[model samples]
Target: MAAVETMVRVGKAAHGRGVFAKRAIRKGTLVGLVQGKVIDDAEYYSDYCIDLGGTLSLEPKTPFCYLNHCCEPNCQLLLTEKRNKDGSLAPSTVHVKTLRGIKLGEELTIDYAWDSVKPLRCLCGAASCRGWIVAVNHVFDKSTAY
Candidate 1:
């Protein structure tokens, strides 16, 4: 929700809806901040929740919640934390950044690399698609070997 209004738009994607670049974006550009509320329990975790470190999670608002995954992704999630005056961690913020130069109209994507209990089949269509929405190390596990 913190993305510049003119910089991105939502459109049709292979998995339903996806975020798309509204203009050419250079590598390392700060695409947008993912604004959301902290999810305090695992039972509330949804597919849209972003893992904050390993213990915390965030459920981001629109635009960010619509980002889809691709094996050969052009973007990545960046987590930033500010320290509180007492030396404790403040709530972290997630930023989306371009991993490579992205052309205008290209769907913005990140590798989900989910370590799910029940992985879903991927339809990203990337040449190097891992086929399942799981972490790279788990992609070849005998139970779900690709």
Candidate 2:
């Protein structure tokens, strides 16, 4: 395994500045915790394009926020649920891991369906890639497991 380090910088992917995995990540493992500067939803909205998979205000530290939403992602974002104002779930610590043995220089992304109803479009160019990224619950017929 490579040393735990910030191997990638926050920059533009399909969406925005998404950090990618620098090396192969094992299954059922922990990636970096998504702790970063607290970004207000209002501020993020003002700055960003405001897509379906944007501004996951779970704990301001969830890996889900860092893991850009991909239609054919190799990672999964598991959320520790907590009740929100409208009886909805909020993420505590979003755990990101490889769904399989991801190759080096690959972007570490996850399906945002665990939280969003419908996500944004993805242009990752995977063979089985879906045209758009949607939430697990609100996933479309073309929605596939990464």
Candidate 3:
């Protein structure tokens, strides 16, 4: 069997560690898979937890965890569910896909849209920067956009 080529690499970013494109990637490409330990506690919290539907969350590993946020992002996360023959639930998965073409060496980013307890200041530097790492729905005022 032929080996699959890697599409991303980890490197330093303005926001600390970040994922970068190893090659020029086209729009809608599957860039990476978010694999992690599944935490069943709905009340569990972490800086790295990713919602996996229902009462589950993912503590993503390595490359996936290093992906940072951008107000105007070039990537997006997609969650998919699986089921058994009996129609019961199975393990879910999250995929990182490109929303637009990504150039080699360009840092891959997603809209975190976090509704964090203590809202984090954003340094994504996108022209349309929301100024905070928060969900748009949580932004109530122009002055305090979180």
Q: Which candidate is the best by lDDT?
A: 3
Against the reference, the lDDT scores of all candidates come to 0.83, 0.54, 0.84
3-91 in candidate 2: lDDT tens per residue? 33644345456655576666666766666554545343743542212232335453333323555766677776555555679986443
lDDT of 1: 0.83
* lDDT of candidate 3 at residue 73, scale 0 to 100: 96
Which of candidates 1 and 2 reaches a greater TM-score? 1
Off by more than 4 A, model 1: 1-3, 139-146
For 28-146, candidate 3 gives per-residue lDDT tens digits of 98887788899988799898788887788899988889989999999999889977799977668898989999999999999988876577779999899978888977844445444
Task: Report the C-alpha displacement of residue 136, candidate 1, in angstroms.
Answer: 0.5
**Collision count for each candidate, in order:** 0, 4, 0
RMSD of 2: 7.4
For candidate 1, write residues 1-146 as lDDT tens digits.
33556788988887689999899888889888889888766566688788875457899888889999889999999989867799976668899989999999999999888887677778899898987888888744546534
Which stretch of 10 consecutive residues in model 1 shows the poorest summed lDDT? 137-146
Please give each candidate's TM-score: 0.88, 0.56, 0.89
Tell how far residue 69 is off in model 1, in angstroms.
0.6
Candidate 3: the clashing residue pairs are none
Best by TM-score: 3
Worst 10 residues of 3 by lDDT: 1-10
